[model samples]
Target: MSLSDDGGYGGDGHRGPETGQTRTRLPGGDGDLYGSGRRPRAGMSSRNLVTIVGVIVLLLAAIAFANRDGSGNSESGGDSPKDTGPGAARPTAPTGTKPVTGKNGQIASGFAKTEQGAQSAAANYAVALVSANILKPGERHAIVQQVFAPAKVDDMQSRLDAAYSTAFLKKLGLDAKGDAAPGMTYVSRTVPVGTKLVKLQGDTADLEVWCTGLFGTAGAKSTTPVTSDWFTMRLQLKWAGGDWKVDGFSQQDGPAPVNGDDKTSGADQIAKAVEQYGGFTYAR
Candidate 1:
């Protein structure tokens, strides 16, 4: 989404990321079995019909049992069984490899030359880019410099400055400097749910990150109370200066699921939670 004057819903009007669609087939009628001009024999009793159905059911069950261990269950053809699970596989345990051992300013840097490293870099950069610090001119510039390729940093910084201008801050109930008013807590946090490497070449990679973010102000008097959002960011990364850096990126509304029925927290509680929790440096 763009960082324009309309809070965080600045781009397209979609509520969340695009979700997969489900298809369903209704049961066909038995009219085809008995022709329009034909009917079951008058001699046929209800008991006979029941028996016929039982036989058909048994025959189908036997066929299914016979094919239980057939090609449908094999992993070599069609879609792999693992790929047809409820959603993406559960994240594996850490491989004991550190995400990144180096930092550029406050952002993670020095990623390894591997797919995992690319994912890690994308995740961390997603978090940093959506952070409240990105609204401040100085911190925004620093973050752009650290997370982006050196060649693109200046251009990105200029674009971002315009995107997060004073008018945009005012629309979000913040001041000219992007600070929340007194007794209000401004929130802009991103949590990466998962990362998928869409394409990987020798020195470039495209990664999509599913993320949930909290943004807006928190306080009883706040016009824009804190709220959550779901989206996927597609990041085009390049191996530059010996580390994975963002070359460009785009965002789309989500693969968001239905919201739960839990009670909403009060302004004070939300504000306290945001203060008590710290963000993580994510890895794939």
Candidate 2:
């Protein structure tokens, strides 16, 4: 009947020879039914692993490059002078009456957006706040009034006056006005360690001035010995009067370290030294 006569078994329309199932087999060397399956050869798997490793290596390299360039980090902007911490000496102001920037090209304006600017302002302001000027009643009032915000000025001034009253001066062997005894040397020097910007926004900067100061008398026979004190001064600063101005600032003692024993100088010598050496306008 044509080729259809032998369709009973394997003659024409039969199942597979081995499994006896009707299925489609691709033309290959007895592989899987769908296609040749060589179990994803070892070479191909290794190549894929190598590709992944290469991508990871590239990512690591890019990270290293970014770090080396100092672009992706916080302190690497090329615009300002190097930050040398708080021990760095700031430039002295011309009048010796105000604060100044520490390094050249450092912007100390309160209006500055850079970190250096904020730091510089805080350091200088701290120096001004803790100067010997605060011992004088009139000057102290002026400083508090000028430095603090309008709302807080009177309260701060009264509190400061009480804090530096005749009793306080007596404790330091000074008169009511906080002047050093005539024969004894009164040492009150505030040296900034470094400044940190806690927060900075347009027209305002919140800063902390980490400072170490020498207070009391430095003379060998002095009733009050010279001592070192550490304090942090917080400042809410504003750009006003053509420079960085302190809107509200307050000081509290310590975070100080243990005392170190050092030889003491004579009172006259200490007094003379205090008279000779002047203060600085600190910058960051």
Per-residue lDDT tens digits for candidate 2, residues 183-217, read 56666577788676666667666676767765545
Q: Candidate 2 at residue 263, lDDT?
A: 39
Please give the clash total of every predicted structure, in order. Answer: 5, 3
How do all models score by TM-score?
Answer: 0.70, 0.55
Angstrom error at residue 206, model 2? 1.2
Which stretches in model 2 have alpha-carbon errors above 4 Å?
1-114, 219-221, 250-261
Query: Which candidate leads the pack in lDDT?
Result: 1
lDDT of 1 by residue, 1-284 (tens): 21211122222111121221111011125311111232222444454344333322332232222223221111111332334342244564778888798777778788887878988898998888767887677788888888878777766676567655676556556677768889888777788899877667788777777887765566765544454567777677889988998876655567777654344556677789999988776776
TM-score of 1: 0.70
